[model samples]
Target chain A: MSTAPNRTGAVADGGPGRAPARAARPAPTPARRALRRARTWLPGLLLVSPSILLIGVFVYGMIGWNTNLALSDKHAPIQEGEFVGLANFIALWQEARWPAAVGNAVVFTVVFVGGALFLGWLLGLLLDKGIRGEPVFRTLFLAPMAVSFIATGVVWRWLMNPAPAERATGLNALFVRFNLDFLVNDWWTAPDFGMAAMALPAIWQLAGYIMALFLAGFRGVPEELREAARVDGCSEWGVYRHVVMPQLRPVLLSAVIILGHMSLKVFDLIIAIAGQQIIADVPAVYMWAMVFEVRDPAKGATIASYLLFAVALFVIPYLVWTVRKERSEGR
Target chain B: MSVQSASGRVTAPGGRAAGTTRRGQTVKFVVLLALAVLFLLPMYVLLVTGFKPFAEATAARAWSLPQTWSGEGWAAAWEALSSGLRNSLMVAVPSAVVSAVLGSMNGFVMARWRFPGADTVFTLFLFGMFIPYQAVMIPLQQMLVGAGLMGGLFPLILAHTVYGIPICTLIFRNYYASIPQTLIEAARVDGAGMLRTYASVVLPVSAPAFAVTLIWQFTSAWNDFLFAVFLTGPNSWPVTVQLNNVAGSMVVPYNQQMAAAVLASLPTLVVYLLLGRYFMRGLMAGALKG
Candidate 1:
């Protein structure tokens, strides 16, 4: 129900007699109309002022400040500063470790995103078919999303650590049985398997999130379509492949973009699991090291800027796609 | 709605066929049960291992329960984590409440009133969400240091509040849009000013959305580790950071680590379980619609 207009615009204006009394009113003056518009908007602007102020100062402002820092050499002390004119960027681009870190980041992103999407879709498909105790199972699967990465990282680290033979968990034991201890060697010695090991914890934690998104998408599909496919004697797999998968495209796209963006910025999981000492090259980890561990603000800012550039490469496309999709959907 | 399939079979709405659906439902249940077990494995490992002694946890049978039950690890974790928990709550509660309140107001204005620069402001906020936190970490830290808030809870709170506004505003604004515009119009006609309309009319009607935002912002703030680690000193560290410290200590004890992890995560877990239904519904409503 709507609110009632009152006299002086301060109290209820719509009771049985009030509405009829106001109905036979004269139109407002142009100046009064303008005043009314201003009155309506004034409070809105005031209400939102704090949020706009904070975001403008910290988010946009800091980003601008970071870009400036990237162009300078101020690693020695916070106060001491000198403009490097792309020297840091040049050094970052030519550095052997940076390329390796970039490669590792790319690999981690691809595997985590691809693996989570595949496994999540499979599980979602299974669960969508009128599963028993559906709510219970759904909650169980989605539990990981609720837990902080800090906890997950520690748990996974224990699960992955090779030195502590007494506390060796799943991955460690498997490696021992297979005599694959070399897999845990330093990245400088054997990078491929080390990167894969680093990527596993992220995939484990994130797959469930993808499943939840897919489950929501699966629910949105009309049951009539599935029933019709079944009545036609098409196999269950065939129906999912041809009918259900196509309908889930938007959901998958959104999920991928979100996961991709998260993977690019992933820091806590890697740092918690490997520690900054071991794998010092992944952009986030490297950036964290520079800022916190090394106390090199200029270099840290440079790394951060590059990371932002990388993230923008992915985000711009996703935003464009989402906007286009929203427009098509008449949103 | 009536594009028939190539097989030429007519289907009922929502695909609810009586007998055929029941038979297929049974098969589906079986498959789902197996998947559920797979999903529950890690949780089972975590819960069981938390109760075990260090020795037992270190044993080859890591997935199984302890030979004898003990709550000592949990007690130790509690004792060790109490300080961190206090710090976490101190930062998280304020950050969440402040962000949610301010964000809701921002959202209410943006959604209901078409003001000049509102869209620009909203877009600018949205841009913040896409930028990685790592990208701004250095400058933000330096800024905090320069402001003399370094190594304190203030920086962490400020950073989280800044990061939280974008998503919180997006969620609330979208939800507010679905609210019938007539309510606000009526409030205006009744001589309600902006603040009065928001407090007496808008907010009271948006309880469900507020609850969802509260939980989300709280959990995010509580779960934050990067800022807690980088910005705050030891005294101001959150539970997540404390849990990492427990994990990183020289003589790392698995049971204690597990216990601390469990303890650190319990609040958010409880929040999730209590509001899981509303949380999921709110998320789906926003995600699917927007």
Candidate 2:
């Protein structure tokens, strides 16, 4: 058995001279090395191929296709598309509703993002103070984060409904108690207050998520620094302003960016609360009207393309910031 | 761990000391309790409404308890919303599993292998993360129509899988990067192939990351409404769509809608609670610091 070819080769390979001599017999050519490298990378490429392929085809490719569609005059049952360059964009700009939608989106983004961040940070600060029943409070606050936007929207829509006879507890009753029947009627009818009503449910649903993010950030802040500030006779607010706030800036920005992105794409909550018949300030609702209600795919596509542009405006800055940060972090 | 003495009283440096901190603690506790109640009001209202009869639910003081307890709302909602829940599960579960598996594999390869276009490919996927869903919605719908897969679960699943990839990949890649390379080198030295290394060594240590990914993806897919509305018909609609329909319609029973909302939201809430600790850690572990 020892003298068999494999056994003998193994035994012989253990001897230094024989092993070196065998190893020195040949070195692969550059072409062969290249082929070996390709062999090693093949499995990895194969593993990632599906995700890459799907993203390439659907996300990037469709974006280009939509941009093209936005430029054309193609309506329902799109024919051989005529290159009616910029006509759709001009029409989109000229529409009374489009500007309203843009304004609504901007206002919604600012209010939702800013308000959520502020309230979230405050809650996080309270939680960080070694409050008792920490887990219970944390869970209670975070429950809304777990609730589906669908549920939030539905519940809020019910709350916001104008029927005085149907006005229940929660914000509706509170508004009524305060002589603010405007919540049920004038809030949705008055253009100025209508947007606020639409935004209320969204803010309620999202504030918890923002709080969670801030809680995470608060956890990351070292206790020693906080203690040092306190020892120096810093007021609670001063400690937060100086020691905590500086460290929390990045997390705050990230949360804002994420919330901002979501707000730009917001549709369901608005639709659920106001229904399609009432609120016309949101571009997404308008787009839905154009596509599903009116069955004008071309106009719908154009409207959707405008929304896409809005999303890009919010997302691109965050993406660039993220990438730059990642690179700087040497990842 | 040092207990520093303050004003002749010893207390943990950053800790909220007992007796000495009573006033501060009480104030904080009261504030927190008040906030918690306010925070939970909507859910309380939802639960109350769900348990009431339709008539009571629609009454002026709908938040008040019904004259009699009833299961009619639950039964009605369960009957009406069952199909929607089923549709949601079908789309969400498959999308989650596929996205997690594919994303983890992509992360593994990207972290371990140095390929020519790896950086560019990874960057491109990140680009998808930034592109708003609205931006791609129209084109994606058209493309699905072109492929004859629109108004079906398949398109929604495909769309979700694509949408989920960027975040999933980002998560797993960041996770795998933190894993020491020596493990991989050791596996290689032991004559373990790529699959053997991942299956035997890499994945075992990756349970926390996988758990987080699974929960996150599951909840996200389960809750998604935008794509569900566009990509599927009423027969294939998810709970979100049904919820929307019920909520949007004028004659919808408030009690039934509330019951349905609770039922629709329960599973994700349960999952979040069960994995709360791991989920928070996973969220923190991501590239959040920068």
Candidate 3:
């Protein structure tokens, strides 16, 4: 690590790029110089090798093994099973619970991401308005990002207590108090929409962080553009719509990618709120139930492999974009 | 007269805009304030309920203020979650520190050193960030069992540290990119090698990045539920798992559950509230970068 960083620093500082090659060059012993060059690379290699090994075994190696397990029918925990050739994947199509979980995942991801992005953008715009007590409001919005979903879930579960009408506590209790009886429902207890209800706290926990992301994005737009737009007789609304929103396209994409992957793989929030129930099941929760509760590793691995596919749908494109951006920048 | 201002009622755009904006500002303030209350209501409920007696908590309106402050709930929760809190701290601290150091090294090599396939190596590490924990848990646990490291805090720490590498590396890589290459070159000119320059120059200059990465790692590791549930059983459960268990206890007391929730959230909440600026910086510099 030491020698390699130094050599790069030396090359950057005095060699190759910024200046022309010197006319006078001294010839060194070829073999010795080659050995010296390799020696310089040792520390950097040594420094980075451990992380490479760890990530290799823990991340990629495990992922490869999961893909392998998905292709097999390994029911027993310790006992190895034979390859089944996409049987598990086919079996997933026939499972009622699998499809229900997939549907719930769709609702939850869309609502949660949409909710967070919308709320985040509103809050971000509000913050950009430079109102009084900005710091106080900003803190209130952003603080929940630090909270655990389990904690959020526990509180929301109580808050969303599905007690009917006047007997309600949590959110319903407020409706009863305010005579907004029509507004109250059996949140998370109503059939078919509990997972959607569960997305409330998920949104609550994340929206502020999303807001912070958008606020950062909003702040990145040049002030001069907004002023110039205003000077040209544009309203504040027009300035934001044209000058600001267009500039925030990348931020919007980033938010979607980040929030998209998060929602796809969300496990703790559902498990914490509903405890692997049939109604609110997402793949992560279902996968856990299959592996641990049912001891059906084959099905579990299949679900997991699908989850990986879902994550890759968002991440692979992102990784490609980022890597290409870095490569272009490097050149 | 020259500007025709006194000839008739005239409105300068800036003056009228400010007047309209002032009114709009109040509307925005009220809307935002109301939302803030809505946002803080549950947290407020969690806080005050922790101080309410179980009887009042069960009988009174959930939104009502505590009639009399009490510590019984906290006492009960502390009894339940103290060990989990300890275990979480045990898992989080070492994992965060180790990952931060490792990330700095990896990032340094990647950002500063121009080696063959370094970008590929980095992208490989970055891939670690995106893979779902659920996708890896079965093999991870099986491998842990095979290594005889299963059923302990070690697995939890190792999992967090290993998973932490990608984000931590990204943060450091981004951070180190901003550092003047001339600083490294200056050290090189002084006959300092990588370790020497990094030790004396880079390490000191990296305090901000370290704070960001450390805070990020600690918060994520603390809030982690899936790993704690899968990697470690009840004995080594982090506060999140234990808090869940506490909430799910057979004779569920609302006050006690609220207390446990508060306790479970306190570590990250305090860190966030106190070092909030750093927390935001970390989020921006890492995963939430838009």
Candidate 4:
């Protein structure tokens, strides 16, 4: 099964023809050795080549092409405009809404990622207590993950009605019914915290994902480890805080990276809930409006490039680290 | 693997088997119940509002049961979303199968077959997963337009399939990596070439992997909104796009909109509920093993 060549530079073949007689003979010529090597790797390369080609063209090639488009003064998708250097980026910086969009994105990332992590961890901890109907609760928590954000946004927009006092609806109306009138406010219409309000739905959709990750992490903690901790005079809380939580750091990191990147690219939900509103605008929604609605390819591409750059700031390092860890784990 | 010890000495008051006290368990359950109810509130609203007649579907009465339940909303939703659902199926099914097949091949090679710079290639593949689709959307749209493949389900299928490569590959690669090398070696020893070995030894036990990738790809492609908006036209609008349109229209009744939302979410939701265990496996595999 090993690919390493044994001593004497003889390639070990897996065929039935791999006999002692061949090993005893004089070494084959370099050309023959190369052919033997080709026979092993050729099929493997062929198997993976299609994916490599597709990813090369669609992912890497497109990124390069997008950067070029961003640099150019292209006003529309159809036109290949002249190279304008940083004019597009300059325009985006000068636009009043650009900084607002960035601010909204920051607010969104904080609320969405932080809220989902906290809620998901709490739910995961609750589920790990060996409760009955664990699957039922897990399913309920995860049901939103199954539903499309578009659908969730539709329901949430109704729930977050921005109507006046007498015309209240959705959650506001429900609050009125429960005499919790103080809790009712404009959800996604408030100028300052609109993006944070939008994060409510995002958190609802993703908290279950974090829960699932942490639950898996919990399962990986051996029963013996907990028992040993208990035997060492550790209470249940101590066992969880000292032993279990430490083991879940990787899961936490994964959840944060996953949720962070997702929040950075938040688009569909916002568009579904509020169509291109400045109050809730993130770069992603702004990019969509720029490209499709305004037909300004250069500016749109500039915004997109920044977004890609922002995501790559974290994702590329994480990917590289994970790969290195996997390799170092002897895979 | 068990280490048998002196039972009385090891028998602590609170052990893994003995479980927590009844009161603590009840508190946890009660907390979980409250959370579940909170989590399910939106769904309850969706269902209750959908069943309500148009007049009663307004926000003020959103929490109440339908005063006079009617099927008009469901009927209208079906009428609007049915075509989009078909279009989505057209996009999702092939996207899932094609990506899964390609990923299986790539995974088998990467996991079992050693090649120069394989890890680099694998890492490159992984990088594709995290990329903002916006970065590539412009080029992809122009490329499709230039190639006369724009404005239909084809571009969506292609986009999803191409984008799906990294994740599906990661899933299958991790899955196949855990398969003992001895099995592959045994197949090779029996005169099976690489393809033959994969066909005979690898593909049989690949059902779980296939289930994971196919379900993953299907759900994503089905739920996609950005690509559907940018890549396709009204003629090829998927359920998500159609749902957005329905929900966006001010003229559409709230009941109908709720029904449409439910209709749009049903397929992936149904798949998720029926195959939840496998779905969770896919989630864990993508997250932890990435």
Candidate 5:
């Protein structure tokens, strides 16, 4: 553990992209040098070997195993079925529930991500105004983040109760008390807007986190840059629009990637809010029902693989770009 | 334009401009206050409803204070959730400790030791964070069941520890990078080998990193429902799964369900309330640094 990081730091002083070549150069005494090098590398390698082994078997190996299951005819958890290539994927693609779940996922992602970003950005701006009692407000905003989605779901399920007219309760009841009859509609039960409505609690839970991210981004904007923008005949709005917002693009990208992948893999929140309802079904919920409830590992694995594919489409690239950017910056 | 103000907003020079700024600040405050209240509405409901009797906790009276407050719900919730809470603690504590230890070692190596292709190894570890847990669910179960470790909190603990390594490593790595290189160099000059240096030098100053990773892992493992449901049966269901079952049951009153939610959430809430700064640090490290 010690030698790996220590050696990296030693090489980093020279420059990025220079370590491999320098280390590859011919040594004066091959045997002694090799012995010393191995001594340096072995401890660090040994230190991280357990983690590498676990991640290797659990993450990468599982993906391969899941893919194998998706290709085979495994219906029961214990039973290993014969090889049946692409049948599960084809079957999943043909299922009406899969498409509905996908659609709901899209809607959920759209509202959850968009709402969280906007609300969090707004809160960030509000807190950035030099207000008093900042910590108190910040605490209030971020408290929801500490709560489990199951707990949040339990409370919100009541809050968004779908009963109508004389039987209304929760938010709907509150709306009626205020004579806002038009607003007293079914939440997360309305056919078209169910998933969108579910985003409310999600936004409530996560927006504070986004707010923290944006606030950091906002604070990290050097005062000199804002001063420079202002001196260039820019108004306050202009300072933000041209100077500050651009600097926050990376923060925004990070937030989007984080929230986006989460939205795709959403399971606990939806299940907690509404127990695997078809109207609000997401791929995760479908995958759960398929594997655990329905006992069809093949179909479940297929859905999971698709979800992985969808997530990897964005996450892998973002991760690569981030690493490459850091490397280019010579960090 | 006083430098003493916490935020970056500059006050205008003129009194009139200052008055406008003050007014704007008031408006901002009111808007923030209103939003804060709105955000906290569900929490208020949870508390109030949990204190109410079943009849008073109905949706129509959800906004009303209970005429006759009772601990019946709280008592019942405690009865239903006490075991699950214990289970959660059992799973979360070990998971947090093990992950923190492993992550510290991995992070120490990644950040300070320096190896060829270390960045590649780090990136591979990071990719594990984004993969849907579903992808690993089936195989992990098979492996555990085959090994006869499928039941109880063991599988859940094992899963949390393995899955947590990536984020914990990321947090610890970023943290260790910020430590001065001279310190490590000084330790090395004392003729301390890698393990000894880490144990005596790096580990001492790692409290903040440890705190962040521990709080993060604990909260995640505690809040986790997916793995808890899959890996553990009724006897070992964590607070989350138990809360779900309690809330989902038709016979359970709304008050008990709300009470159960509160009970289930209390530990993480307390942790956040106490160590929120470190939690936010962990949050920022995960999002921004990565």
Candidate 6:
């Protein structure tokens, strides 16, 4: 039955049609060839034009509008204000709250991003080694990635309750039970070190994802490379250290980039865990407060722009790299 | 892909089966397994606390299994969140489907029949994937609200789809890129037009990729709190926002909050458990390509 169509089609189209068709040739006139060539782009553009137009207006246009808002002295949406270049920016320098939030973000990003990458890489190393119940362990480790940061924060909030004496709750209670009472401290409120504690839930939420990435990276290293290394008399740890670990640099880079952007723009997790307090404020949390709660739209826009620029610092390079890679690879 | 001994105390594992009995293999597994359990402990607390009555929930040991279990907390959670759950589905499902369709078209075109500036257009769409929602929130809200679309699911659906375009395009483009150009050429060689060729030749093979993109978008939309909080008012609150509200109740609805958290997480959790491989593939694709 399948051969019937092939048999018939082969017999029927056995003419000059095959040659011209293969050549993508047409009426043998330059005008017609030009039209044919031009027609090829129409469907492709027609297919994607809607997305390009909408995304242009929505994402890029919004970003441009946001920058304009940042440059103005507007405090509320739909309100017109004079062009006040860098006024909000100057004000932010004097505002203790903004810089405090920036500090918190820096601290949070360093600890959370570093911790997650290290922990995820370590787990990947273990899982990369052949082990029983591999999928089971993988699933268990990666389960948290499924849940929202909001939910994860809600639970971690309860866990990190900072109480003194025998009345401790959550994790502090465990320290009390085990007589490691010195370890009990106010998490996310522990002054200077609170951001570190505040970063725990974020780490918990993302470490598994980083692990999965690194695990994939680990598995991707061809077995033949490891075998070749072994034949050259490299020990197990030596092989991993010299061969596998070196090859995982890209995975490590990706994890850091992903985690870094996440930490910079972190909002819901902090709000979920600690509410909108200054102690736990990141730039994102502060931006929300300024815009909605404080009703200072100019400051909010400025903060958002700053955060956007900061994130662009981490992201634009990567985007350019992707474009370059794709262009160079010709696909 | 693991090799276990008869007593289940064995060595060697995944990606490479049947290797050696390293000296500390058992110890390593025990530590790794223990860490895995600890990583999962918060959910355990979430479940245990949700099951217990309020009194035990607040006063009893946090880790203990519920002494006296009841569905009261769960009922209260359901009461609080049922409307929000419906809203989440209403917002997420349509947005997911719309984005997937849009992405499929965009991808097929970009991969199969690109023209001058096509890469530039594709790159523009790709940039949307990295724009943190915070950067555009103020103007976005203004734009959406100016058009009388605020305080409802429409704005949220629009926001998610617009934001979703980049990722959806990336995934779909990568998927479509794998299909040989010969297939499309063959379709063209036949009497089929562009849309007909897509419907007949390309769309038929798009099921698995659709599953990947749909699940990714749906889970992301389901888990979103920032957009839901900012764009929509209380009338169209999603489950994540509701969970936060319930957690902040003055009387402290801890048990019900836990239950609500579990309820909120269930959809994506089920997706991850059942189609986890696809989910991971989506994640890897986004990361690797970007």
Q: Which segments of candidate 2 are over 4 A away from where they belong?
A: A1-42, A164-170, A174-185, A231-233, A278-280, B1-21, B281-290
Expressed as tens digits, the lDDT of each residue in B1-290 for candidate 5 is 33223233433222112112545677888999999889979988989999998778776687998899899999999999999999999999999999999999999888887566778889999999888899999888888989999777899999999999999999888888877888877665555567877888899999999999999999999999989888999999999999999999989999999999999999999999999999998888778463
Which ranges in model 4 have alpha carbons more than 4 Å from their true place? A1-25, B1-15, B288-290
**Candidate 4 Cα deviation (angstroms), residue B32:** 0.6
Question: What is candidate 4's DockQ?
Answer: 0.54
**How many steric clashes between backbone atoms does each model show?**
6, 0, 4, 0, 12, 4
Q: Calculate each model's fnat, 2 decimals.
A: 0.56, 0.54, 0.55, 0.74, 0.66, 0.58
- List DockQ for all candidates: 0.41, 0.46, 0.45, 0.54, 0.50, 0.49
lDDT score, candidate 6, position A98: 82
Error of 6 at A4 (Å): 30
| lDDT of all predictions | 0.73, 0.72, 0.82, 0.86, 0.86, 0.82
Off by over 4 Å in 1: A1-36, A163-169, A174-190, A225-236, A320-331, B1-31, B281-290
lDDT of 6 by residue, A103-217 (tens): 9999999999989988888888888766778789889888898899999988998889887756888888877778899999999888969999988998888888988998888
User: What ranges in model 6 sit over 4 Å off?
Assistant: A1-32, B1-20
The native-contact fraction of candidate 1 is 0.56
Q: Best-fitting candidate, measured by DockQ?
A: 4
lDDT of 4 by residue, B170-226 (tens): 898989888898787666555566787788889999999999999999999999999
Predicted candidate 2 versus true structure: per-residue lDDT over B36-141, tens digit per residue: 7777777887888888987787556666777777788899888878998998889888888888888788888776643567767877787787666766777777
In angstroms, what RMSD does candidate 2 have relative to the true structure?
A: 6.1
Candidate 3 residue-wise lDDT, B1-290, digit = tens: 23333322223222222213445667877989999999988988899888988888863368888889999999999999999999999999999999999999988877775456777888888778978888898889888889899877999999999999998988888888777888877766665666776777788889989999999999999999999888998789999999898876658688899999999989998999899988998888655351
How well is each residue in B1-290 modelled by candidate 6, as lDDT tens digits? 13323324443443353233544567778989899878978988899999988877764477778889978889999999999999999989999999999999998877776656777787777778877789899888887778887877999999889899888888888898888877876766665556776788899999988988899999999999999888989999999999888886657667888898999999999999999988887887678542
In angstroms, how far off is B87's CA in candidate 4?
0.2
User: Highest TM-score among the candidates is held by which one?
Assistant: 4
TM-score of the A-chain for all models: 0.81, 0.83, 0.89, 0.92, 0.90, 0.90
For model 3, the docking class works out as acceptable
Candidate 3 Cα outliers beyond 4 Å, as residue runs: A1-25, A28-42, B1-20, B288-290
In model 3, the Cα lDDT at residue A305 comes to: 93
List, residue by residue over B1-290, the lDDT tens digit for candidate 1: 23223212223345433223444555666776776776665566667778987677664767667898778789889988999999999888888888888778887877776467665677677778778887777777777778788876888888888898987787788788777777777765665666777778888878777787778888888888878877888888899988988888858677888888999999988988989976665455334333
